[model samples]
Target: MTWNPSDFNNTSGLHISPKDMWIPELIIHNAVGDTYELRTSNFMKLAISSNGFINWNTGGNTETSCKVDISRYPFDTQTCHILIGKSSSLDYELMMIPAAAKINTFLYDENENGEWELLDTSVGYHAINEQMTFLKCTLILKRRPLFYILNILLPVILLSLMNVLSFKLSINCGERMSYSVALFLTFIVLLNIVADEMPKVSKTISFLQLYINTQLAIGMFITTISVFLVHSTNSKTNDDVTGAVHAVYKFCKLCSKKQQVRPESPKGDDQHEDKYIKSGQCEKLEMEHVQQTPGSANAETNQSPSIVDAVNVIDDTLFWSFLMLFVLITIVFLLLCLF
Candidate 1:
C-alpha cells in the first residue's frame, strides 16, 4: 500500500492494535518458570509502514534456567542463555531470523541491577534434529563484589586472624579454651550465613567454603593440642617427659635467645661474652648472668627446665609456626579466589 506523500500530510507510518495483526510467538525453550508466548500486549501498538511492512517490538522479562559454577564466588562471572524458539510447527508458513550477531544494550538498559552488570551478549540462529530452529542468545554478567566484601568476606578473614591469635594463649591459661571455642563458633555461624546465599552444595562447591572449612580444621587442631598440653603438664614430671620433648624445649630456648640483643659487658668481659656467643654458649652465658643477679631465685636458676617450662616453650614455638601458616594460606586463598 504505497501512499502519496501529499495525500496524508506526509505521514509514512501509523500505529494500530497489536491484536489486529500477526506476531511470531517466540518462546524460551530452557525456561525455568512458565513459558509464555513472546507477543506484545493488547495495550501496545504495532507500527505499520505505508509500504505494508510492520514493526512489532516485543521486549519483556523472561525466566530461563541458568547453571552456575561458583568456585570464585563474589569474584566470579556467569553466563546465561535464552533459547528462543517458535511455539508451533510453522516452518513452512513462518520464518524467524536474528537481527544481529551481537546484542548491545548501551541505549536501552535503564533498569539494570545493582549487584550485576551485563558484560556482553550475542545471538545466533541454530537448527537442531533436522527440523527445529531456534535463536540462542548468550549473556555474560560480572558481579560487583563490594557488597559481599563488606558483609561476608572481610569479616571471615578477620575471624580467621583471631584463630591464629588464639595460639598465643597458654594451655593452662583459663582464657585459651574459651577463646578457641568462641572463634570456632563464630566460624560456624558465618559459614551458615554464607551457605544460605550460595548455590546448593550439590551443585558446585566454592573456594570460600573450602577456605572456611580449612580454618575450622585448624581450630580443632589447636583445641586438641591445648587439651593435651594441659593434661600432660598437670600429670608428668621432668623425669617422665621424653628426651624428644626436652630436646624440643632446648631448641626453642636457643631460638628465642638468638632473636635477643646481647647486653654490653665491661671491657674485660667482652672476650668472655664473645666466646659464649660464637661457640653457641649463649644459653650458658644467660644462666651465669641470671645467677649473678642480685635477687635471682635459686629454685628457677639451677635446675633443668620442668615439664611446665617445656610446655611454655612449645606454646611459643607453635605460635610462630601457626602464625606463618595462617598468613601463607590467607594470601594464597585471596589470590586464587580473586583471580
Candidate 2:
C-alpha cells in the first residue's frame, strides 16, 4: 500500500529506520562461527518511497564455511558463498528476492581491495525444499601474484639452480658434500614456509607445492651422490676396484654422454676371433695383476686410469647435465601451470 507523492511535500523517499518496518529476516545458513545473524545493524537507515518501495541496505562481516581449492596457490582463484535466509518459515510466508544493486545495472554490488581482486559478486536463489527458499551471494576472488612471485617463487627457483651447480665443487676440497647438504636443508625450510601459508587440505595439492617437492627430491639425490663421490675421490681406487665402483664409473660415463661401446672381434687370433669384446671403447678395466718386484715386465700393462679417475674425468659433464635438467623442468612446470 502507498500514498500519493503530493501528500508529503512531493518527496520521492524518506530516510527511515529498518526496525520501524516489517522486512524479511535473513540469516547466514553456512556460517562458521556463532555469527550467523546478517542483521547486525540496529539503527539502519533505509530509503522508504512514497509508493511503499524500501531500499534497506543491510550487510556485515560474515564468517562462512567455504571449500578451499589451492591447486594454483599464489596464483589461485577462490569462490565462496553466503547463504542467506532462515528456512524455518513456509515458502508462501517468506521468500527471497535478489535486490537491485544501487551502483550498476547488475543485480549485485562488487568492491575490490588489496591482494585479492573481486572477479564477480552475484546474488542468486536456491530452494531447500518445497517449503523454503533462500538467497545466495557468490564471491569470486583472484589472488595478486606479484608479491608471492618475488618473495617465494623467485627465491625457490634461484635455489634450485644453485643446487645443480653443487656438483661442480671439488670433492677433495670438502665443499661438495657440505654444499649439497646445505641446499637440501634450504629446500626443506622453504617448503615449510610455503606450507604454513596454505590451508591444510589433501583434496587438491597446488602446482607450487609439487614443484618444490620435485626440487627437494633433486636436492636429496644430489646430496647422496656428493657423499659417494667425495668418499670415492678421497679413497685409493687401484686395480682392486669393486664391481659397484665399476658400475658407478659406467653411470658417470653415461651422464657425461661419452665413450659409447661397440662389440668388435679380433681377426688375427682365430681363438679370440669369434668372441666380441664390448668393454673396448671404455678403457679395458680388466687390469692384469702386475708384479711390483724390480725388473718385472708386466708392471707397465696396468697403466689405465682407475674408475675413480673416470668419474673425475666426466664431473664437468655431470654438472652441466644436472643444471640443464633443472632449467628444463622449471620452465616446463611454470609454463604448464600458467597456460
Give the runs in model 1 whose Cα sits over 4 Å from its true position.
Answer: 1-11, 90-92, 104-112, 236-303
Evaluate residue 147 in candidate 2 and report its C-alpha lDDT on the 0 to 100 scale: 85
TM-score of 1: 0.77
Question: Candidate 2's residue-wise lDDT over 26-141, tens digit each?
Answer: 78889887846645576678878778877777767667888978887888889988788873677788766776432132543345356787776778877787778777778888
Residue 268 C-alpha lDDT in model 2: 81
* Candidate 1: tens digits of C-alpha lDDT, residues 36-116: 567745666888888888887766666788888899988989998888888876667567788788876767563468888
The TM-score measured for candidate 2 stands at: 0.77
Q: How accurate is candidate 2 locally (lDDT)?
A: 0.74
